[model samples]
Target: MQLPESQVAVLEAANADEATPVDALAAATDLPPETVTGAAFELEEQELVAVTERVDETISLTNEGRTYVEDGLPEVRLYEAALEASADADPAQMGQVIGTSGLEGDEVDIALSNYARKGYGSIDSGELTADPDADPAADPEATALESLVDEGTLEGSEDVLEQLERRGLAEVTESTVREVELTEQGVTELMAGVETAETVGQVTPELLTSGEWDEVEFAEYNVEADAETVEGGRVHVLREMSERVKDVLVGMGFEEMDGPHVDADFWINDCLFMPQDHPARTHWDRFALEQPTHIDDLPEDLVDAVERAHREGVGEDGEGYHSPWDEEFARALALRGHTTSLSTRYLSGEEIGEIEPPARFFSVEKAYRNDTLDATHLLEFYQIEGWVMAEDLSVRDLMGTFEEFYAQFGIEDIRFKPHYNPYTEPSFELFGTHPTTGELIEIGNSGIFREEMLEPLGVDCDVMAWGLALERLAMLTTGAEDIRDLHGTLADLEFLRNAEVTY
Candidate 1:
C-alpha cells in the first residue's frame, strides 16, 4: 500500500522484534521528533504499528543547585575549612567557620547539620574539628548533584531525589514518552515492501488543470479525525452581560447614573445613615485612601444635616444613636463599598440638579471592598444599584422590581429573606436558585431606604433601592459555579468561548 514518506520511514526504522522509543527512532532516522510522533500516530491508525506512552519522572538541578555544585556543597566547604584550621587555632564557632566558608544565614545552619550528619566532623565545646579521613568522595549527594548537572537528568532512588528537593536544590517533573513498535501486520507489510511515493492529501487547482492527479497517489481521508478548534474574537461574557443589564434597566424607564469609585465617606456612609463607628466602616472592611484625606467642595448644609441626624436624630419618633458624630471622620476619603453611594448622590441632588418624585435611577459600576479572594467573593466587583424615588413606594414595589429585573435574565425563582442593613429598614437578602446546583444562592442585599437614611439626604419621598451582585447574576445565567470564572484572574477561557449569550 502507498504511504507518505514520513510514515514509510518510521515503519522501516522500527525493530520487528522489539519496541523503539520515539526519541531513539527520531535520532536513528535523522527526522524531527514531532514528525516521528505524527507519523507514528498515523501508522498506528492503519494497524501497521502500535504506540505506547509511559510517564517518566526525571530529577534535575535548579539554578540554586547548579550554584551549589559550582561553589562546592556547603557541607564540603565547611569540612575543608575545619580541616585546614591550625591545631592550636582558637576554638571556632561552627557558625563562624560556616560564615568564613562563604555560607550565610540558613546556609550556615544547613552546613553544620549536614557536616555532623555525614560524620565528617564534631562541634564539641564550641570547637569544630573535621574527620581527618572523612573523604569528600564519600558524599553521595554532592556526587549526585554534579552528575545531574552534567547529564541534565537522573533516575535514582525517590528518597534521594526527595531529600534534594526538600533542600530546594532540585525538582522532579513528569514527562510522557511515546514508544512505537511494528505489529505483526506492520512486519508483514514491511516484508512485502511498502511504497514511499508522495501522497497528495489535498487536490490543488494546478493538479486538476494539468491532469497530474490521475498519475499520483492520493492519501486516504479519515472523516472521523478530530480537527483543531477555532475560536473567533468575541465580547467578554461579563461585558456582554453588563450591557444587557443596562439595556433592561433602560427599558424599565430608569436613567443610568454615574459616581466616583473613590469618594468621601460622608456620601458612602453618613448620607446612608451608617454611623462612623459601624463595623463596616472599619479598616478591615473598607479601603481608606492615603492621599486626599478629605473631600473638598461638599455642600455645607447637607453635611451639617447628616451630622445632626447622626448626633441628635431628626423628626419626631426619630431617636438617633446618640454617638458623637465627627464631621472630619465623615469627610475622610475611602473607596466606596457599594454603588448605593451613587444613588445617595443622585437622590440628594448633589449630582443632578433636582430629583423629582416618581423618578427611577440605576448604576452598574464597580465598588471596592477589603475582602478575601475566594470562589465567590472578589476584592472589587460590579454592583447593580437602582432606586425609585416616589411619594408612596412600598415593599411590594421593591419585590416586583426585583422579580422583573431577574426575569430579564431568565431567572424566575427569586426569594427574599428579611434581613437588616444599617441604611435600610425592613431590608432583604435576595436569593436565586442556581441553574446548575439547584441550591438557593444569596445574590444581593436591598431594602427601602429608611426614614433615617432618606432624611439625611434631604429626600422626603420613600426610596425603594437594591444593591445586587452583578457577578452572581452572571453566574446563574451562564451556569458558572465559581464567580471567579466570570471575570476574575482565574476565569476559564473555554467557558468564555462557549458561554451562552442569550441570557
Candidate 2:
C-alpha cells in the first residue's frame, strides 16, 4: 500500500530517533497517536528501520526489497461466470424479492419464532458470524483494544464494555435503561423527537474523501431504523416501578432509606430475624460472598443488637433461636438480598433516639440469591424491602399498605399465605396474580418484627418488614417470559417513558 504523508513523516521521525516515545512521535508530527502509529507501521513495511510491538515481527522490510521482481498477478479479486444463469435462483421467477430480500426474510422469521433457541442479539445473519480467522495471537478487535490499552486510552477492565456501550454496543450495570413508564411531560418530549434517529449527520468531505474509507466502519451507518413509527427511550420498567414505590413511600411521609447491595449477615439475616440455620442461609439458597468479611465501619450497637437477637430472641419471651449466636459468622459480610437491613438501622439507633415516636422506612435495592437462573429466578436481582413502626401498628395496617402498594403497580389480586420468619411474630407471604400466566406468583414476604429482632434495637413498638420482587411485576405487566425482555430494548424504554403506571 502507498504510504500516506503521515506515514512518510513517521518514517522520517523513526529514522531520526530510535529512542523517541510513541506519544512523542505523534506530538512532534501534530498527528493523532493512532494515525502516527499506523504511519510508522507502513514506513516499516516499505523497508525503513524496522520496529514493531509484536515480538515475532520486529522490523520492517529491508532495502533488498526495492530490487525484488514485481510478479505478474491478476488484477481482479474474482469474477462471476459470464452469463451465469442466476446464483441459486428459480428458473423463471425473477421479480418478487426472491434471494436475500425474500429468503433472508423467511430465515429471520424462523429465528424470531423460536426465540428460546436464540437471543434477540443473536441472528442468522452475516453480521453475527464469528470471524473466520480469529487468531489467538491476533484478535483484530483485541489488537485495537490492546493498542488503545497500551496507549492508556482504555482504562478499566470494563472500559471496553463501556466503549461498546456508549455506541449502543455495550451493556453495563450503570447503563441508561429506557423504562416502560413515563410521565406526561416525558411523552410530550418523546413525540417531538420521534424521527430524530432517522436524520444522519452530514458526512464531511474530510471523512468520505480521506482515502481512509477502508478504516470507516459500515455499522455506524447501520443505525437502528426509525422509518417504522415505534417507541422511544426511557428508564427500565423495573426502575420505573421502583421509582413509583419510592414515590409512594415519600408521599406516605415515610423516610426513604438506602443501603448497600452487599451487607453483613448480622443485618441481612440476624437483624431481620432470619435464622442462620434457615435454608435461606445456605449457599444453595442464597449467594454468599466468596470472602466472609465485614464492612470496615459498622455501628457497634447494630452489631451487638443483631448478635443478641441471634444468641437469644430479642423479644418479650426473651428467648433466642435457642442456640449460641456466632459472632464471627455474623460479622461475615454478604451481598444484601433484601432492603430490610435498612429498616434494622432506623428502628434501633441512637440517631433515631428521642427524635420521633413513629417512623417508616423502605428500600428498593438489588438483591442476590443462589437460585438457578430461569424465567422464575435469577442469582442476582432486586427487592423492595420496607418496614413500618408506631405506637399501635396492626395486621389491619399491614394489609392496607400491601393492597395500596400492589395497586400502585396495577396489581390488585393478591393472596396472603401464612408463613414463618425468624424475626417476626406473625409472618406472611404475599402472592400476586401473574397477569399473563394466571399463576399465583409469590412476589414478597412480610411480618411483624419478632422480639429477638426489636428488643435489642431498643425499639418499644412492633415493626413489620416486607419486600417485593420488581422483576416479577415487570414480567406480569409486560407478559414477558424472560426477565431480559425488560432490558436491552428501545421499545421497552419507550413503553415505560410513555406508560402511566400509578394511581
- Distance from true position, residue 192, model 1, in Å? 3.7
Over 152-228, each residue of candidate 1 has an lDDT whose tens digit, in order, gives 76535666675677566887777778889999999999989999877887899999999998998887654433334
Which residue pairs overlap in candidate 1's backbone?
none
lDDT of 1: 0.83
Candidate 1 off by > 4 Å: 14-189, 198-237, 372-376, 434-440, 456-458, 475-502
Positional deviation of 498 in candidate 2, in angstroms?
8.9
For residue 400, what is the lDDT in candidate 2? 89
In model 1, state the lDDT of residue 141: 80
Each candidate's TM vs. the true structure? 0.63, 0.51
Q: By lDDT, who's the top model here?
A: 1
lDDT of 2 at 119: 21
RMSD of each: 13.2, 23.4
